[model samples]
Target chain A: MANNIYIGVDLGGTSIKVGICDENGKLLHQMEGPTESEGGPEVVIKNIANYVREIVASSSYHWDQVAGIGAGITGFLDIKEGIVKLSGNLGWHDVPVKKMLEAHLGKTVKIDNDANVAALGEAWGGAGAGIPNLVCYTLGTGVGGGIIINSQIYVGSTGVAGELGHIAIVPDLEAIVCGCGQMGCLETVSSATGIIRMAKDAVERGDKTSLALVEHIQAKEVFDAAKQGDEVALRIVNRAAFYLGKSMATLAVVLNPQRFILGGGVSKAGEILFAPAREIFKRFTPEPAQEGVDIVPATLGNDAGVIGAAGLNLHR
Target chain B: MANNIYIGVDLGGTSIKVGICDENGKLLHQMEGPTESEGGPEVVIKNIANYVREIVASSSYHWDQVAGIGAGITGFLDIKEGIVKLSGNLGWHDVPVKKMLEAHLGKTVKIDNDANVAALGEAWGGAGAGIPNLVCYTLGTGVGGGIIINSQIYVGSTGVAGELGHIAIVPDLEAIVCGCGQMGCLETVSSATGIIRMAKDAVERGDKTSLALVEHIQAKEVFDAAKQGDEVALRIVNRAAFYLGKSMATLAVVLNPQRFILGGGVSKAGEILFAPAREIFKRFTPEPAQEGVDIVPATLGNDAGVIGAAGLNLHR
Candidate 1:
């Protein structure tokens, strides 16, 4: 039998990425094209099919070797049905994505939210490779998460499993309303937006800090200031890490994944963020759950989405 | 072909319960006998073997009809090795339960902790029947939890997944040390022990409460007092229910189980505990996660242990 290859599509508002992965989830070939989502779902779907074919045509593997196609889309999705129920970024509603893609490419198709797809990518080939159970946290504009169990993405009853940012870790006294309308969610403190908010709040409160000098504050500025031994900036960084570690402690007992993978821009703060999160995880987690469990960074970076989507047909 | 029957053994400190369950996890027959811990591991092993034979012999089912045996023990277990690493309740250390049981029964045998077994029982034939994913909470002396994914008990790495009681939920200022040595754990406020403690604290603090008139405060007294409109007792009950609800909210996002099953003695408080817990769960959970999800009571009660034990081989 010929070796099988998988196709993964990272459908974004501005660009669509397509990658061909070998059985081991190693990217063999890749191509990128504009999404032009404004052209409507039909045009976007055709672009995805064309990109997938182009990737395979450029690769060493034959088209017959392509086992299946999978996509990681941003928005509320009906994963089982492969439908985009609502996508603010794509301006899509009730788009029958799987059926359209499968019709164009004549192959089985699968779809998952971007966070889950990225986590699966890491689990299949990145930081969580060979680890059957793991959790991934993406700390970008908002916190995102994916739960991987038995090497497959675990999308809970409504495909909302691993919504880690909404874990509600902050105490009421310190809590602020989250974008999800919940109070004291993990994202309210641990996300890049949350860190930036804290920095701005500190500056507005007239705390002695270098952040006051920055014209427009960002999470990077906060981390940079903290790295320079700025006390106020350090407090903000600790607060963000504190909630993250606490959320992980809660997840440790609930899911008991073998590893936790941290990704996204906020995680780039390096030891300034990870050190306290790891320490807090250890302090709050019961000793038994913490044994042999580790916290690590996602190794795939931007490629996790494409690689994980390719794994959907195989791992799922 | 003959129908298969499963043998389940619930090993406790003072008693050993044995039952026969059909493929559906329905308990056909059950019997209980002394654990005879003073006689040690060897005697208990023989006793369990005898009970297995006695039940099948007394019933219409033949010995050959029995397919496999499973036991649920209370302890720290090396599940993969089928060893009880430490069991404070059973006074056991490093007992190879699966090996000994397989030796006596001459059949395939499996073992898991009591909490996981009960949750499996509920998932298999009780309230969560036909639900492939769910979380179960046993609010007894200490809150115990089990995660069921794809109809199987998810023990996680090192067999410590689903230890919900130790989830640090209370704010640090108001939190106290838990038996697990963690502060502000969910069990500190939500377990039966937690409820009793709150009542004792209220009385000792010179609060004018009816609980002060009681000779020995139990969880039941607190519930009864609350039913009678005792303000302090109602507050304690509400506090217990509050944490349980909050923990469920956390679980909803993490596991996204189809249902949340509440079992154990404390759950018997019915509407008082359930109403508040459900309301809190709704308040804390994001709309999408809570959609189509429910919090319900466990139906199998004590039988859950034996039935879930019997299901280990089938489910696992």
Candidate 2:
């Protein structure tokens, strides 16, 4: 099975990324195309099929050598049945993605949420490689989590496990309404959206800070300003770090994963975010659960999705 | 093999309870003896050995019929090596409990934390019987928790996994210092100590309530007064139930266990605690994760520890 290959599709609202990997997890070929989600689920499905065929056709391996196909889709999913339960980005609801792809490609198809796929990719080849029990946090617009137990994705009974951001760690007094309609979720403070929200609030309150001058503020701009000793920016960054670390401490006692891999846009704030998180994690976690446990930035970055989707054929 | 039996020991500060269970998890014989902890670890170990021997001698089964022995003790433990890391109740530290028991009885011996053993008991034959993935919360003086994944205890990297009560779900503004020294742990607000603390605070604030008349306050009194619609008592019970439900909602997205089993002294409050917790759980949890999950009282009561200890030989 040395030449046995798998096709991975990282499907998003804007584009579809296709990659082919050999049994050893080495990428042999890649391609991309517009998602055309405006054309609805039908068009997106067709584009994914075309990309899979295009990637395999451009590679040296024959179609017969491809073992299976997998897609890292955005939004909620019925993973066992390969249905996209609801995806705001893709404008899909109850779409039978796996069935359509398998029928078109004539290969077995597997699908999972983008977060879980990213985690599988890291566990297969990135930061958490070879560590069976690890959790991945993707801190983009929202905080997404994926739990890998004994080298497999742990989808709770209904295939919706590992929602770390919503762990309600905030007290009622300090809590703001979360997008999920809850109060004081980790996402309300730690995510890129949350960081920007805090920065905007500080500037709106006439706080003394450099952020007020920036016409368009973003999570990155807040981090950049904080690096230059902007007090308000620092406060926002610290608040984000505080809740993020607190959520990790909460998770430390329950899952106790050996490594916590941080990814997505906001995590790139570097040590400005990670330094305080590590310190807070140590302070919050018990001695036993804290020992030998590590917090590290994700290594794969954007490619984690495609690579992780590729691994689904083997790891899932 | 039909007549094969396993010996279980539930060791505590006050007493040591022993039981014999067949392979099918039915208890066949039982007995109890004083812990005699005033004499230290050696005395406790000897008492355990004698109790196991006596239980078998009094039963119909002979020595050959005893397959193994398991002890569930309070405190930190190294489950793999069967070492009681630090048990305040037993006044033990770095005790090689499994090795000593095996050498004394000539049978395979296993040891685990009391909470984990009790969880295994419920998973094996108690409330969560036949359920593979379940989390048990024992809300006694402190909130203790155990995780059962695939019907086995989930000890993390350093044998400290399943510290469910330590999850920092409470925010700082509404937080109190927990016994574990962390601020705003679920145990700080949801445990029996926390309930009593709230009751004390109500009385101190000079709130007009029936609780002020009761000189010696207990958790049961709070529940009794709440049943009678005492304003202060209902407020205290509601706060406790709120945190407990919130913590379960937080855990629901992470582990997605099939059931959340509530046990210990506070759980005895029945629907006054459960009805509100269930409602809060539904409000906080995402629909998919909440679909089949159930919050129910533990059925095994006091026998859970002994039965769960006996099951360690087969399950762990």
Candidate 3:
């Protein structure tokens, strides 16, 4: 019999990505549409509904060949109920995303955290592809982590596992506060946003460096300047990499993943970021953990979320 | 038919604990023997053989009734080969614990890290009994942890899952160096030794407290003084709880275990330690993670290591 196709929905804040994936996770065809997120949950959900319908109709494939729909959404998901318990990005709270979409499209639907979906994507089709057990950290605005064990995403006891960004890396409660409103989370020093903040602080204090030349600097600007031999930029990048490395090393000792795949925009700097992170990772991790671990770049790149969302069909 | 008995051997640096467990993880009979560990691995290995044989023979439960032997030894085990890759405590490196034990005991042997064994114990019969997922934090001389998902211990790609002690809760490198030789580990703040160090620092700085009356100022002394409302002791205890709670919160965000089981001698302070830790954990953890997630006392106490060792039979 022909293998069943699965619909993977990447429901983001600004855009909704949908893909037709086979049981083996091969993307047969894909489609994208604006989330219309500012229109609130009702309009955004309608856009998602239209998005899936269009994917099915526009693709050179048959609906009968589809097994089920697996949606990787950004928000708090009640996986068991397939509900969006609360979604900050989509501006939806307690929206029954899976049931509404499943009812509209007349099919089964499964929903999960986007970061978890990205992890599933990496685990099933990217750097973590061949590995059944691993964790992926996306070093974007904040550090996002995903865990896969026995070829399945671990959602903890109540459906939230792999939120590494919120972990308190620094115990100094008074010095810095995290996005989660906690003090001294790992993201304060390791994330792209955090890196920018660190660099901005250094520059504003009248430190002489190439970064001072920029009118308004972002994380990538620091990376760009670092590439051009900016001492401050270099220091900024190294500091970010240092903490990230420390974070990964600490994660390695705890989770002991075979590979640490770095994804998101900042990861594109490639060897520049990875090199220093590796050196520092070795310095922090113990002998046994460092012995068998490999620090690798993410293979899926930007499409990881979409691909990972699609991979969910196979498990369903 | 009656379930066959399983032999569980716990090889610690100071002592060797063995148990005869049924399929349900109930210990049919148990025994304790001196490891005379400093007597070398050969002697330790022999003691394990003699101990198991002695238990099986004395219980009137014939050797045939005993299934296979699962040993949780103190070291980094090469799971596939059943070799003790390393042990900082036992001064062991590259020792074939399984092969030697199998030859002497005339049975197959399964080997894993001791903490992993402790996790298994809790999962199968102790605090985590009947629970599908949990993170066990053993607060001994140093802090150690094990992650159990779906009743099976997660042994990361490199077999190092649940080495939570090594995760960095302390941000700076020079603050405290772990005996694992890493800097600012969670163990540095939460471990028994770390607690004593904190108390000593307070005393050295002339903090007024009931704990100053003690000669050596151990962790328990501080806990007792803190219970009596000693300012210095309360400060030290609360500080330790903050780090511990932060660590637990970080782990809870990532692993999302059903329960955070606090074990080992330090945990004996009961609510004096757990109460503040829970408060900090709740304060630090994000939504859904904090909901229904529990920070409970370890139920199995010292027997956790032996019982968890017993869990290997069912896990494999």
**DockQ, per-model, please?**
0.87, 0.61, 0.66
lDDT of every predicted structure (CA atoms): 0.93, 0.87, 0.81
lDDT of 1 by residue, A81-185 (tens): 999999999999999999999999999999999999999999998999999999999999999999998899999777899999999899888899999999999
Candidates arranged by lDDT, highest first: 1, 2, 3
What's the TM-score of every candidate structure?
0.99, 0.91, 0.86
Fnat of all models, as shown: 0.85, 0.70, 0.90
- Candidate 2's C-alpha runs over 4 A off are A1-6, A22-29, A34-68, A103-107, B1-6, B22-24, B36-50, B53-68
lDDT of 2 by residue, A1-316 (tens): 4478888899988999999877655667788899999998888898999888887787788899888898999887889999999999988999999999888888999999999998888877788987888989999999998998888888877777888888776677788888887777888899999999998898899999999999999999999999999988998999899878887898889888899999999999999999999999988887767878899999888888998898898978
Residue B3 C-alpha lDDT in model 2: 75
Local lDDT at B265 for model 2: 86
Q: After superposition, how far is residue A1 of candidate 1 from its true place, in Å?
A: 3.8
Look at candidate 1 and give me any clashing residue pairs: none
Location of the lowest summed lDDT over 10 successive residues in candidate 1 chain B:
B152-161
A39-109: candidate 3 lDDT, tens digit per residue: 88778768877887788888766777777888888776788898887788777878888778877788788
User: Can you rank all candidates by TM-score, best first?
Assistant: 1, 2, 3
**Best of the candidates, DockQ:** 1
The positional error of residue A104 in candidate 2, measured at the CA in angstroms, is 4.8
